[model samples]
Target: MLDELRNDPVILSYLQERANLTKGKIAEKLNIDTDIHTVCVHHFDYIDTLRMMMFYLFQQIGLNVVFYIPFNPNAPDVYKTWREIYERVSGCDYSRWECVESSQPNRGTKFAQYLDKCFPHQEDQLDNIRFLSFNHPTEFKEYLQKNPIVNNQNEVIASYEKDLNIYTDCTKSDHFYASRYGKFFLSLQNCKKTEDGIFLTYDDYVNMMTSGWVQYGSINGTQALTLLVDLRDYMDGVESFQNIMERLQSLVYLQEVSQVFDEVAKEQAGRHRLKCYLSNPFRCFPYVHQSRYQITVKQLIECTKDLARKVNRLLLAEREKKNVQLYLRELYKIYLTVKDKWEPSAKQKIEKLFSIHIPDHWEFAKEELYQLLTFYLGSTEEQENKILNFDQLIGKTLSAENIHVTGLSFKTFPWKTPELPSLLTHTWLKECIRCSFIATNQNIRINALLVDYYSRNVTRSTALYSIYHLLAYGNGQITFSYIKDLQENDGPSIYFMILEELYNKEKVNLEEQTEEFSWEETVTTQEEIPKEPLRNIPDLLWLDSDFCQRKFFLNAFVEHHPVYENDFHQQQAFSIIGKLLAEQGEGEELFRETMFPLFPQWTNAHKQNLLDTSYSSGLRTYK
Candidate 1:
């Protein structure tokens, strides 16, 4: 990433003035201080800050930095993310630096046992830096694939706080041997609130899948344009399905292709779903297709016309009683020549359209052909649009006067393992468990990518000195605030435990909040439109009526809001249960009588609430 940035002309333009400057000249030009030394290191959460500091020291100021690192088993990603950030930063710019970590954690991790054997321990081993900073660190694996990963992170945040507070390689003192290491240990805390971890998390994914698209559509765009009357605009002079299909293909539409396949429901009151109709063609056709997406009207029309001609020839040959197989092969070849890979839906549709069979073994001869058709002719896809854009404000600590820090939520810290895609299990991702092999299908395999994307952040420093840098951006009047009972769909976490302990002091009168708190006092949020951003539900048994009923029950229960039932913690619990069911394929075959029993962990109240919802939603007479 750093390399890419350096290669970028814009970024290089930012650095060009200093590029030719010598070390002393660069220091003078950049106004960097050279006299900084005696750096003490804690967790390597933000390596960017460290790298930038080192660059100034070694490159401009010309001094080698000795880094004291710690290998915490519980926080290997701390090391891993450090390595990742180091690579990213140094790839563009870096300096000479060396690190000495716990030669042995002294306790009994596998790495520790190996190190303990390699070197002989002398008396007063704790005094040596090699044997220092090692503690009985917890394993990170204990937190993965929970009902949702955030639930697991609650424990992780609690565990890490303890690790920071009590444990060290040396004797526990008031300074805890702080000043002995560096004259000033930059005690940076993780407090700034963007989606935690460099890799995209669930919140980011959700943000991308909402409201609008990266680009809007024209022709068959928006809800108003979806009506049958609007189809004539693209049809131009001929009201043909082929004409409309040609105009719509590959072009972005605001309307989603209805998932419900009931043809009668599809033709509700004599038209397709009008919810996404392009209320104004002025906004749709020319602006969206011609201007926005850079797709001309002529291009869409020509593509569709070309596709129609091919299909008509096939139909004419069929009418003439010509060899249908030959035309079918040509059709398959035509599709293959244009498309990167053969799509199953394309194959199925073509076969069904011609009432012919396409053998899987047929390897159509390769040739270049302009594809005049698209798979999704009247559908909308999630065209990702950025929700938040932030500057790379990690380490430059020169600016001063006022600072306001935000996003101190648990969701943005301790780095919750992102919620895996539906119907994919953690066991499958980790060890390729075949007890229920998920990679058996493409949908499940694609979900595997989510795991890969998320797993990288496992070691990438999520909570770097971001908070420090944010505060340093404007030094004076530092202000940060977090709600005790935030409407984040969470309750008391380990952070709360720390607070409970703090408030337990005699000077403070606050007691441990063991009881349920009111939601109205916390935060208020409004209900928005339900978005089917995605679902990996197989087009298999879940499509069955009985199975659909069960799925409905599960989804309804997960999505149930008890009319102003605004308890965020309860919402979190509900959302978690929904994720567990989807990932584990639960409740799909359960009878109403046995459904509650299957979820033994769900409390009686939850079960009752679900029952109430089911009844109120007109799903009466549960067996």
Candidate 2:
């Protein structure tokens, strides 16, 4: 066996590490006449198998041999395998020994019990045979009763110690243990204990090897961490080995556990986001009661960061290029919007790069919205309507202005005149028109065009006016006379329904009085104002307010009677005129001429009338 091991440097190294095994060292220790060769297998299973194999071989050759199971090896050993002992010893004819030794009782000790039960010999032969079980070796020695055979036993002790010391010496001086290779092997042994009290050995970890038990596949990793540490101690003076082991430890410890960690991190992030949302919830306000885009964005940001960190670690350890690129790309998209929202200073520079801005506030006028819409439209590909089906159309429209398209129709040629099957997609067109005309503040031509489109419906005009009323009021100007014209007219092109909802929902109290008044009494305030509906008077007058001036082209063609009247009267007149205008688009010469002069600036003063209790009471009653 020693000659067979001569060519294997690893085995030779293990052998040479043994101390007290020198031919001269053995003589100094034991002064024995016989030579003994010893081999060490760290595992108890292998040791037991090898011992049995040697027993048969030595016995067959008629060599006097003794076997001893030593104590306290480098690591805890596992139970022995029955097959290794059985197959190797089969040629020894165990049946002959069994018959001869059958009468002797078992050892009754757990470790040696098997030997006693399986190996029986004649009582006299058993008496001559020595059982050197170490469980109570001192007691067994005393039982020997001072037989001179003890002298030979002491020699065996010297022999065993000599072998162990020789192995130790070999380990100390062996270059393999002192080289970078030894340190590299040691590095794999770095691992921490699991919570369940299972000590994770650095090299033998099932999870690390298998990517979780390593099963039938090779997990290809370092040794148990503790074992590696032990190896490091063995190579203490070897600088190369020490460096290799430390580097390996660093690599293993640096591994990421992936996105699961990111989600755990979100608890901290959510608090910050909640604070921002709560500050002005309606603005940046969080929807505590339900999930919101802000929450999703936050999660995505965290995930991206975690993935980014992982890729960075990989780049450092393995230089995995593909992994680095994929993660970097994802990181950019995740940060694009979050940075804009969380860090406003970074927004301006990257604004054109991405449409990260949230939707505008409700107070945005149709004209401004239209311009924004146009800009957003230009950002995407200019495709024909077909490729962008109803869903895509709805999505783009809603995303652009927060308006939902709920209904559709094929084609409704011309506005105002009723057609079958609602030929045009009503909801889509309404939303688009609302976004363009109402939200963006398009000109009179667009307004006229909208009127033409919805010509079949008188209330559509009222709805249009109502949206304008809210915007005007929000700007600090209550179009009282316009409200009246809208009230008296058979539903003006602009209505106050939205204002009513806003007021009801918010419970805002407007001090202005609402009263019914004859057109004659109302018009006396501004004789030059349009004599149209009370609603028309405000549009007739305030149409030029900084807020209303932008979309003049939308309602410009609608003739205004340049005479001021009671707001209720004006509202009523415009409602009627709006109906007439909806049914009859662009051709009212008398009204057109009356409205001509009021063009640039049209609002009339009705402060005194607004203060009247009767007027206020009348307006409330009308609603």
- The candidate that wins on lDDT is 1
lDDT of each: 0.32, 0.28
Q: Kindly report which residue stretches of model 1 are placed more than 4 angstroms away from their true locations once superposed.
A: 1-45, 48-220, 223-405, 416-493, 500-623
Model 1 lDDT, residue 476, Cα: 34
lDDT of 2 at 9: 73
Candidate 2 RMSD to the correct structure: 43.6
Model 2: what TM-score?
A: 0.16
lDDT of 2 by residue, 182-263 (tens): 2321222232222322222323222232121111112112223222332232222322222333433332222122123334
Q: What global local distance difference test value does model 1 have?
A: 0.32
Per-model TM values vs. the true structure = 0.23, 0.16
Residue-level lDDT for 524 in candidate 2: 44
Off by over 4 Å in 2: 1-15, 18-84, 98-297, 315-623
lDDT score of residue 518 within candidate 2 = 72
| Poorest stretch of ten by lDDT in candidate 2 | 406-415
Task: Write candidate 1's Cα lDDT for 167-262 as tens digits.
Answer: 222212323112211110111101111222112222221121111111122321112222222233322332233324433452223111112222
Please report the candidate that would top TM-score against the real structure: 1
